[model samples]
Target: SFVASGTFSRVFLVHPETAKTRRWKEKSHDAQRYAAKVMRENDSYIQYTSDARKEGDILKRLEASQIAQGKEVLTMRCFDSFAVVDEVGEPYWCLVLEWLG
Candidate 1:
C-alpha cells in the first residue's frame, strides 16, 4: 500500500538486481541501496498526489534533455509502470522503485 504524507505519496528502498549480482569491492564496498518515490493514487490530498506525478514527469524530462545534450544529470532512474497492490482486501496504487544507495 502507498502512503500519503506531505508532498510525497510513499518512499521505499529496494536493492537492484545489478547491485546484488555484481561483485562487491570486498572491504571497500558497502551494500548498495536504492530509494524509490511512489506516487499516491488514493488520498485525501489531491493536489499532493498530482504534484507527485508532476515530479516524476520533471525527472523524466530532465533525463531526456540530458541525454539529448550528451550530458548526464539524473543519477537515478524512474519508471511508469502502474502498480496495483492488494493489502488484505483493499487495493492500493503504488510505484515500485529501485533503492538509491
Candidate 2:
C-alpha cells in the first residue's frame, strides 16, 4: 500500500475525495489529487513511542503559527487524522495532506 525506500520511509498517492471522503472543493474528482506523508520510527536506531502523535502535533503547530503570522509560505494543509496502513512488516503511520504541486 505504501512505496518507500532509502530516504523515504513511506509515501502514499491519494486521489481526490470520492464518496468515502467529503469533497473539499467543487473541482472534478479526477482533476484533483492529494498526498500522504508517512513518518516511521523504524528507520532510526532510537525509536520513540507515539511517533504519529508527535508528528501530528508538530504539523498542527506549524499550521497554526503560519496562520497566526499571516504567512503564505506553506501552501499545503495538514489534516488531523492519521491513516494507518496495514503493511507487511509494520503499520505505517501517515498524515494525509493536500498534495503540493
Candidate 3:
C-alpha cells in the first residue's frame, strides 16, 4: 500500500502531519517526504540471490550512517519495513525508506 509498482523501485509521496494550535507554536517544522523501495519479486533479476544481498548491504550501510543527502533539504532514512507475502506464503523483502524531496 505504500508504493505503486514502477520500472524502478516504487516511489511514494508523504505528507507531514498537522499539529494542534498549541503544539504547532512550540516548534518549527519543515516539509518531509520519502520513497520506499520495494524490490519486485516478479522481476527476473530478483531471482538472483546475489542481487538481493548486495542491495540489502547497500541499504544497510545507508541506514547505519546518515550519509546520504537528497535534493533540497531532504535526507534519506531507513525506517521500518515488512515482507510482502505471496499466495503461497512466500515472503519478499521490502524496504521502507524516507525519500528526500
Per-residue lDDT of candidate 2, residues 1-101 (tens digit): 34444353456777645564456746564666656777663344445344555666777788888889998747457674464656576666677777665
Rank list by lDDT: 2, 3, 1
lDDT of 3 by residue, 3-95 (tens): 576554565555556665684466445656556566654455454332333465566676555544442423345565566765897656566
Error of 2 at 90 (Å): 3.8
RMSD of each: 5.6, 5.9, 6.9
On a 0 to 100 scale, what is the lDDT of residue 6 in model 2?
Answer: 38
lDDT accuracy of residue 94 in candidate 3 = 61
- Ranked by lDDT, the better of candidates 1 and 2 is 2
Q: Count the backbone clashes (under 3 Å) in each candidate.
A: 5, 0, 2
User: For candidate 2, what is the TM-score?
Assistant: 0.58
Instruction: In model 3, state the lDDT of residue 62.
Output: 63
Best by the lDDT measure: 2
TM-score of each: 0.51, 0.58, 0.42
